[model samples]
Target: MSHRSFRALGVALVVWSAAFTTEQACAETPIEQARHVFETRKYTVVTVQLVIKRQYSFGGRGSQEREEKQEASGTVIDPSGLTVMSLTDVDPTLMYAKLAKTQGMSDYKMESNVTSVTILCDDGSEVEAQVLLRDPDLDLAFIRPSKKPVQPFEHVDLTDAAHPQMLDELLFVNRLGKVARRTYSATLDRVEGIVTKPRTLYIPGQQNQESNAVLGSPAFTLDGRFVGIAAVRADLTESTSLDKGLLAVVMPAEHIAEVAAQVPPLESEGATDGGSS
Candidate 1:
């Protein structure tokens, strides 16, 4: 072939490669677009402060009581300050009970009482809140502000949700700990599997371990559709091992919404503070 002909062919190939690379680089993945939307909208990812008191009894060993203050991530589901988070995060009595039984501690007993509940707002304000309902079967806890807010607060619309399939990538948002200034952060996770029997559950990929997603964080599809909240499932059957039974799964938003609908209207006064499940 002539040198001129060879030069023209090489230049044509280079231009084609460059155009393809640019097109690929310009395209954003679904999760990436969802992240942008969440960031711009300033989704309501709040911090929940829980003050819990616990009493422990070990048969003849007698009883002991203690109190602790903890913070957990929660997603605001409505303008009225209705929030949802992992029940286990607020109270771990059931988890402890399972552990004790697993260890064959027939005489072990434990109880937890949520002494105080507060929602930390983005503007550095604190809103007094209380547990409105608790669903242990689903590991979900719904909370609401004690008093009506002067103005509606920003929240995620769980009704507009997405159903993810196995291996599909998803996005979740959570608030960082105090050390990180309690900033809202987003992470990407893939659906490792889907459980259809009993109830629908999305098993997040192991990559979630390296992510900042914590219990109660809201998950969404790459298209920015609400998926559900992150929670731990504890199966305490005699045949199931603890390691295999307890799994981090994303509860379907539909289930959450159905349960949320069951939450009674906010009372004129705060609901009775009781032990969280």
Candidate 2:
């Protein structure tokens, strides 16, 4: 081979290497930015423990009652330990009723009552909390410590939120279940679409088990701006098909903040029952 030909080949290889490096860096930029938000705000994600007593009745068939303890992910929305989570997770009777109707089981009836509530902190401590508000329309529940924490808690500032366009990527942070040691985890999802009529809702792209995100996971933009929280929107219209009836959406943070603003003071804890429909 001629020396001139060898030199030309070497230059081509170097150019290709530089181009590949630049492409790789650009791909990593979003992930690195998202990592900052995850590490800084992971503590805001916590576990909520609930003991619920449920009653089930099959018309003229029989009735059953059971008490079960469950754990769900919750996001701290205020420094005072005010947290928010999916109301459906705490009480799934509504969802069950919808499913039953869809399956042509009109005789199915179910009711539930939250017997106890506790917030599990990252430091292995537990705080007794009570449901301050429940919004079934939006699938949101606000809870606060029975007694204010001695020190301020790390929380997400919902007021400072970002509005993402369709096809934009989002970062979601959540806490794993007991089997996974309740560790904090993160996942990425894209804004699949936006529903503006009736009410504005952001549709997230398809999620799989590997994402490890749950109902209460908080979502953010790639640049570390708060986006919203994951929730389910159930359409109860009889004409609506089951598949299209229930939708998973990212409820805007501003909407959540509006509801959080209505949370009653701790003194009036039992004014609104969380389990009531």
Candidate 3:
């Protein structure tokens, strides 16, 4: 073969090899990893609705009534439709604080009227859910759907997930806002560090604009193991000045399972009475 032809063939081979490697890397990306995990566990993540009522008196006037609706993400844990969501969803103190300041009300009080707690299913159907327990320490709440579906719902076994180490790559699943068709987003982040004071935690590297949306969303390892759920920690120790930001942390699966096991069982049938080890 001519020298020119030999050089061209070698270049073509190199290009092919590079292209193949790039494709492989893309397939294993954190987004892809998150998608794979979600596809299998889609039914576990659900939408929750909370009905709130507010009572306030202005300028020595009698108490008046105000109504509000709030929504949040929850994770189903059992066939009986046990689920967990953020405590702030049902009890929003910060939201009320802002409202009080804005309206200039002397006495502002808000409580969950909770006329109904509806659970949005994976198949786009809705069902009634009931609040069973609230753990203030963890800032987590447990709930159960009132009626059982014909087919058993899927759930994430928190104990099954592997414990993550520092700097490990992980993926989390979060649903878009109401304007968005409730589609889930797969987020990739590195474990920036850990804090051992309150509990063993997995902290994300940097804060992003979408960080608030991912709160209460479940995080997973690349191989599809549940690491924990995304939580926020506010550090005001150093900052007496004014600016306050939230740091994302992973509430480890083991800890979640331990707390979940103690939650009371539903009144319905076919529920697991055994503790989650």
Candidate 4:
């Protein structure tokens, strides 16, 4: 072909390629759109840690020993550094409970001590965090740390009326401190029924504590609006996989007000909460 003809063909090809790229960029599905939002705004979440105090099973009157356990989770609820997590995960307050291995009652004290929480952003900025509030029954915690907040996140929409399609693909984002676990999906086999406080799988007894969903892990529809704070699996019936019973109670955003009424907010940078006995 002549040089002029070849140059014309190359220019036409470049024009077509640019148009295709624009179309692809604008036509992502809702889930794909949501994932891109998270990837761009990941800098606003953080991981928390604390020194949890535990008394020995023995009826000791002095020299109490402390256990320092670290938990990793994520949050994107606020521009003021507020984070979201599992309600039962971090408790710093000391409380009363029965002594271990005996009929004797004793004080089971704990503290909600936060070491440091840092938000890793895409722009190479790491922001620190602190605890805010957590709902006991619903199992969601709101945290905020001490640092200049980053830009507001691409907050998910919370529809007043929404329904989760059965067998639909759901996405869950998990975190381990500063490290992030990849978002995963599961097939909703069945409804398994609902409860007043979305809890772990167990006979409604006073002493069955087998809750599962990781704290701060958010569950959502393919469109990415709020669905529920992850709840524990409810079925203990034998299945091919152990995870068959580990169901997370997807709380609708409307229920957020009810949970807030029960668990009031605090005004300190330190952490505080009592574990259920």
The lDDT of model 1 is: 0.83
What TM-score, computed on C-alpha atoms, does each candidate reach? 0.85, 0.85, 0.74, 0.54
- Local distance difference test values of all predictions, in order: 0.83, 0.84, 0.69, 0.46
RMSD each, Å: 6.6, 7.1, 7.5, 8.7
lDDT of 2 by residue, 67-121 (tens): 9999998888888899889888888888889888877778999989887899999
Top model number, lDDT: 2
lDDT of 1 by residue, 1-277 (tens): 9999999999999999999999885797675687686785445779999999899998678789999999999988999999999988887788778777766776788888898999999999999999878888898998889998997988888878888888888877888889998988877779998999899999987866433257899887766678898988887755567767678899898889989988878765346663444
Error of 4 at 55 (Å): 5.1
Off by over 4 Å in 1: 1-26, 209-213, 237-239, 267-270, 274-277
| Residue-level lDDT tens digits of model 3 in 32-82 | 776787777655777887665666555667877777877788777777778
lDDT of 4 by residue, 73-157 (tens): 5545534545566654564232112111122343434334444445444355656555555565555656554644546653333
- Return whichever of 3 and 4 wins on lDDT: 3
Cand. 4 TM to true fold: 0.54
- The residue pairs found clashing in candidate 3 are none
Full ranking by TM-score: 2, 1, 3, 4
